[model samples]
Target: MRAFKGFRKDLTCLGFQFREDKINRTEEANCVKNGFHCAENPLDCFHYYSDWRNSVYYEVDAGGDLDEDAVDSKISCTEMRLIRRLSLEQMLFEAAVYMVEHPKRQWNYGVKKETGTACNGYGVVRGKNPRAAGEKGDFLLILKEEQNSPEIEEIALINIDGKRWHPHKFYDAYGK
Candidate 1:
């Protein structure tokens, strides 16, 4: 979450320009609240914030079980795929909407190539599911600590697609 705080500041530091007479303070505030900033040079801020967010998200989900359910065992592989597709669609729609709303602050799609590279190289790499080995086996120590403990009820799944899935942590009655 500290990374989120940094992202917000980076976004604000980037600043935003408006075509209207007055800048929208509310919009900027909303961005800050949502772990983003209102950048005058959105393209630059977009790259900065996106890179930062991607890294943080990767670190958070580096060691969780991606196959687990939120509350019940109803999340099958098929259902999970559907949910992932839907979530991706929603994210794309939101990005499109943002671009449309802020035409003056043109959005750049160039970062797509390097989107997950930072996270992959430094955060979490693919085909390397940390949970598969053991909680403490991954490069991320914090993730191991959280997963090894029975008290941690929630786990974050950082998939290759750059999305987060919060799955419930289930254990035996004796708290195994």
Candidate 2:
């Protein structure tokens, strides 16, 4: 069995955006059939990873009435998604550091949060909303050589989301 390496906690927040060049026809079809208008060119589909190592530690030193009815709950998952996106971007920045240090490596590897882990099936909380927004989750991932690279003959992405392991390639628009 190949060794599965874990991603740095700091790079957990690399926001994942669907490659804009690729259009998911199935998603588009569903939206049209349901009469639900979605943001055109929706690219926020991939699961984002974050780097938790650089996260600022906040010490909870005070305790107050934590009643659910006391505070007006107006948080939405959309806002949470925005925050998560930003964290993921920051994590990507941290990943650059690693890539620069390890020039010989072909790709960065890391794990993403699994859906069946904890609350809401999310992994760990990478950030928080001041007004009680959605919670963030964590997972694992690592950068590996691109499958079928000239330097490294064949590489594959073992997708855990599915039952069987399959090989994937970095495809651009027009299936390049």
* Top candidate when judged by TM-score against the true structure: 1
Backbone clashes (count) for model 1: 4
lDDT tens readout by residue for model 1, 44-84: 32344454434211101011112222322111111000011
lDDT of each: 0.23, 0.21
Q: In model 2, how large is the Cα lDDT of residue 99?
A: 36
Q: Tell me the lDDT of model 1 at 127.
A: 17
Model 1 ranges off by over 4 Å: 1-37, 40-45, 50-91, 103-105, 109-176
Candidate closest to the true structure, highest lDDT = 1
Query: Tens digits of per-residue lDDT for model 2 on 22-42?
Result: 321211112212211122111
